[model samples]
Target: MNIPNRKTGFFLVITGASFWGVGGTVAQKLFQEYAIDVNWLVTTRLLIAGLLLLTIQFFKKDRSQVLGVWKNWKVAMQLVIFGIFGMLAVQYTYMASINHGNAAVATLLQYLAPAMLIVYLLLRKQTMLTRLDVVTVSLALLGCFFLLTNGSLSQLSVPAPAIVWGILSAVALAFYTLYALPLLKQYDSLVIVGWAMVIGGFALSFIHQPWQVDITNLTVEASLYILFVIVFGTMIAFWFYIESLQSLSPKETSLLGSLEPLAAVLTTVFWLREPFGTIQWIGTACIIGMILILALNKSSSSKTSKSNKKPLRVS
Candidate 1:
C-alpha cells in the first residue's frame, strides 16, 4: 500500500463519517427547533441526495448504469425491496430515533447492526459462530444495556419511543447491509445505492410530500443546516467513504469509521448540551471496542483468504 494513499484514505473516511455524525446532530436540531417532520425530511433527503449521487455517477462513471439498473426484472425487484425495506427503512428509523432521542444514542444504537448481522448469519447457517462472534454479540448487547438504561435494568434513561425507533434503525441497518449485497456485487455501489434511494424517495413522496412542508418561516441558518444535511451529510459523506476504499482496506476503513459515533456523541453532548451519563460513556466505549475487535479479526482473516471481501457498510 502506498503510504500517502493510505493517509488520504484515512482522511477521506474520517471526514465522511464525521459529516454523517454531525448531520445526524443537525437533523436532531431541526426536529427540536423547527419541529421538522421526519417523514418529509426523509423524503426530501432521499430524493435530493439520491439524484445528486446519480448525477455524479453519470458524469464520472458508466452512464449506462444510471438507467441500466432497471433493465432486468429480477434485479429491479431486488432494488425495489432494497429501496423500501433497506434504504428507506434505515433512513426513516434513524431519523425517527434522532427525533425522539439525541443523535449520540441513535448512532450508537445503529452500530448494533453488526452484532445483529452476526446472529443473522449464524442462524442462516451461512457462517459458524465462533467464540469471538459470541463475545462480539455479548459486548454489543451489554453496551446497549448501559447506553439505554444507564446500567439500570429497571428503566430506560431515554424515552421509550426512542428505544423502539433505535432498535428498528439497527434492524433496518442490518437488512440494508445484507439485502444490498447481491446488487452491490454485480454493480457499482454508486449505481445500486443511487437508484435504491431514488426508488425509496419516490415511494415516500407519495405518502409525505416534501413540497407540502412550509419553509417560508425558516431562518437562513436553519436553511443552511438543512442543505448541509442533504448535500454534505448524505451525498458527500457517502461519496467520500466510497472513494476511500480505493486506497484502504475495508477493515481499516471500518475501524476508522468508529469516529462516526464518537463525533455524534461529542457533538450531541457539547454542541447541543445534551446530558450524557458516565455509564453511558462507558457503554459507548464498549460498543466502540466491539467494532475494533471485529475489524481486527477481519484483518487477520483477510490475510488467509484474499478473495473474501466485506461488503460496503455505509451509514
Candidate 2:
C-alpha cells in the first residue's frame, strides 16, 4: 500500500474538521424541529456509524484485522474505554451542554480541548512545557472566556451541571486525541473506529433506550440528519483524525482541530442564521492565533532539533 503524502493527509484533516463544523448546524436544526433527546441522538449516530464502517470494511478489506483486534482482550478493553470516554462521553456531554445552554456557549467551552491536551500531556510526562506553550494555552483559555462571557465577565454564568458536562466534554476530546495516537500504530484506523463506535453505541443504547421512543414519527429530514451525523461526523471525521495523527503529533493534531469551532461558528452564522456578535469574532481570532503560535513553535522545535544532530567535522 502506498503511504499518503503529508499534504494529502493535511487536506483530509481539514476536510474532516469542516464536516464536523457543518454537522453542528445540522444537529441544531434537527434539535429545533424534532426535539430529539441527546441520548437517543448519540445512540443512533454511533450505531449507524458503526454499521456503515463495517460495511465498508467488508467490501474493501477482509475481516482479519477486525478479528485480530478482538483476539487481544486487553487491547479490546482499552478500545471500550476509548469508546466510552473519548467518543460517547464527548458527544453526550456536548449535547447536554447544548440542552442546558446555547449552541455557541457549548461549542466555545468544548474548544478548550487544546489547553486540556497540554495539561494532560504534561501530567503524563509525555511532554515538557515551553514558553510558547504557556502563551498558547493562555490565549486559548482567554479566548474561551471571552466567548463564553460574550465580552462581559459579569454576565458569564452558566448552570453548574452544564459547566460540569462541558468541561467533561473538553476532557474527552483531549483524551480521544491522546489515545488515538497509540491505537493508530496497532490497528487500522477504520477498524479501530468501527469497534469503538459499536461499543459506544451499545453503551449509549442501554442508557438511552431508543426503543422506548416513538420511531414511527421520525420524519424524513430527521432521519437524513441523523444519517449525516453518523456517516460524515463520526465515521469520516474520525478516520481523517486518526490518519492525521499518523503524521502529526497529538498536540499538533489538536491544535489543527481548533479550526473546528471556527468552522462551526461560520456555518452556524451563515446557514442557520445564528447570531455572531463582534465579541465572538474576536474570540475566534484569538483562538486561531493561539493555534498558529503552537503549530509554529512545534515546527521550529523540530527544525532546531534536527539541525542540532550534526557530526563534528574535526579532521
Candidate 3:
C-alpha cells in the first residue's frame, strides 16, 4: 500500500478550496456585472470542465476507464442519474444562489451539505448519532439561523429567493456526494465526474443552449472572469481536490475545505463590498466551527481513504 503524504494532500486540497472560493467571487461578478445567466454558465462550464478532465485522464492516467465506463449499462444508468440529478443539480443551484445573492451567503449556505448528509444517514440507518454529532448539528442550525436571519426573528438579512436557492444548493450537493460513491468505487473520480458532467451538460443543453448567448457585448474583464471560473474554479479546483484524497484523510480534506467559504466571505466582503455584519460574522464562525469539529471527530476513523473507494468529501 502506498503511504499517503499529508503534506502534499494538504497543499492540493487547500489550493483546490482556495480556487473554489475565489471562483465563487468571480461568478458573482459575472452575474452582477456581466448579467450572465446562471443556466448558460453552468452548462458551458460543466461541458468544458468535464471534457478537459477527461482529456487529461485519457492522456495521463488510466485510458481504459474513460471508455470502459460506458460498457456497463447499469453504471451508465447510475452515472446519468448522478450526472443530471446530482452533479449538474449542485452546479446549477450553487450558481443560481450566487446569482440571486452574493458569493459570501451562497458559499456559506452550501457548506450545510455535511449536516444534511448526516441527517440523511440517520434516516437511512447508515450511521448512528454521537455527542459530537449533536454539537455539530446545533452549531450548524444556529449558524444557519444567524447567517440567514442576522439575529432578527422577523426580518431576513438576505433575500428570500437566495435563501431558498442556497438551501437547494446544499441539498443538491448532499445528493451529489452520496450518489457518486458507487461510481467512484468502480472507476477513477476523474472518469466518473468527467462523464457525469458531460452527460449533465448534454441533458441541460436542450433547455438552455449555452451557445445562444451573445458574446458581442462581452467585456474583456468579464471574459477573464468566465475563463477563471471554468478553468480554475471548476476544472483545476475539482481535479486537485479529488486528487488529494489519494494522500489525505477525508476528515482532513474536509477541514481544509473550510477555506472555500472563508475565501468567499473575505473576497465578497473586501473585494466585492457585499455586506457582512457582526451577526453574519458570528454565523460564519459557527459554520466553520462545525466543519472543524467534523474533521476533529474523524481524526482516527480513516487514516487514508482510497481514491477509488471515496467520493469528494467536501463540507
Candidate 4:
C-alpha cells in the first residue's frame, strides 16, 4: 500500500484531472475531424477501461472487493441501474455535448453538476438550504447564463442541442455521485467504479456494437489518442482521483477537481485552438469561486467540530 502523503495526493488529483481534460479535447478532435461514431467510441472506452481497472484492482489491489460487491442481488440491481442510467447516461451525454460543441464548453457545462446535486439534496430533504447553498446555486445559474449567452439575449455561442446534452450530462453526474455513496462506503471505489463501467459498457454495446466502427484510418497518432482516452483518461484518471481521497477530504478533492474545467479550457483554447469569449472566462471564474467557497466552508466547519471534541482520546 502507498503511504499517505498530502503532496502526493494533491499531485495525483491534479494529474488525474489534467489527463481527463486533455482526453476530452482528444475525443473532441476524433469526433470533429475523424468522423468517428460517438456511440462506438464511448462503448469501447467504457469496456476496455473498466477491464483495465478491474485487472489492476484484482492483481495489485484488494482482490476481495472484486467479488464482494456482487454478493447481494438487491445491490446488484441497484448497481445495474446506477451503471446504465447514471454512468452510461453521463458518459454518452457528455461526449454528445462535445460532439455538438467543444471540449471547453462541454466541460464547463458539466461543472454544473455541483449545483444540480445541491438541488437534488434539497428535494430529497437530505439537507436544508443554507445561505451558502443559495449563493452556490445562484452563481451556477449566472455562470451558465454568461457562458452560453455571453451576457447577450440575442444569440448563443454554443448550439442549443449541445447545451441540452450538457445539462443532461450534469444531471446524470449528480445522480451518479449521490447514488454511488452507499456502494462506495461498503466496497472499494475501484471495484464499484470498474463494475459500474463494465455494466454500462455491456448495456451500451447493444446499440453501439463496438466491433462495427471503421478503423481503416487508425494511424499511430489516432491509436495514441485512443490509448490515452482509455488508459490515462478513464483508468488512471479515476484511480488517482479515488486514491487521493484517502489522504484528502472529499471537499478538498472536489476543490482540486475544479481544476478540470480550467485544464479543459486551457487545452481547448491553446492546444485545440478553440475560441473562448471574455464573458465565458468570467463565467468560468464564478463557477471556480463557488467550488472554492464550498471547500473553505467545509474545511473550517471540520476544524471547529474537531476542536470542540475536547481531545477526549488523548493520552
Best by TM-score: 1
> Of the pair 1 and 4, which is ahead by TM-score?
1
Cα lDDT, model 4, residue 67: 84
Worst 10 residues of 4 by lDDT: 306-315
Instruction: Show the colliding residue pairs in model 1.
Output: none
Looking at model 4, the pairs that clash are none
Question: Residue by residue across 1-315, what tens digits does model 4's lDDT show?
Answer: 255488888998888878888888888988888777889889988898888878889997889889877899988888899889988988899999999998888887887877887777678776777888888889989889988998788999889989999998888887777677666667776777788889999999997798887787788888888888888877888888877776776766766867777888898889888887899899888877776776567632222223211110000
Q: In terms of TM-score, how similar is model 1 to the real structure?
A: 0.95
- Pull out the clashing pairs in model 3: none
**Which scores higher on lDDT, 1 or 3?**
1
lDDT of 1 by residue, 187-304 (tens): 8888888888888989999999899989899999989989999999899998888889889988777778788899899999999999989999999998988878877776322222
Q: Candidate 2 lDDT (Cα, whole model)? A: 0.68
Please give the CA lDDT of all the candidate structures: 0.86, 0.68, 0.84, 0.78
What TM-score, computed on C-alpha atoms, does each candidate reach? 0.95, 0.81, 0.93, 0.91
Q: Which residue ranges in model 4 land beyond 4 Å of their true spot?
A: 1-4, 299-315
Model 2 Cα lDDT, one tens digit per residue, 174-223: 66766665565677667777777778889988777877888788889888
What is the full ranking by TM-score, best candidate first? 1, 3, 4, 2
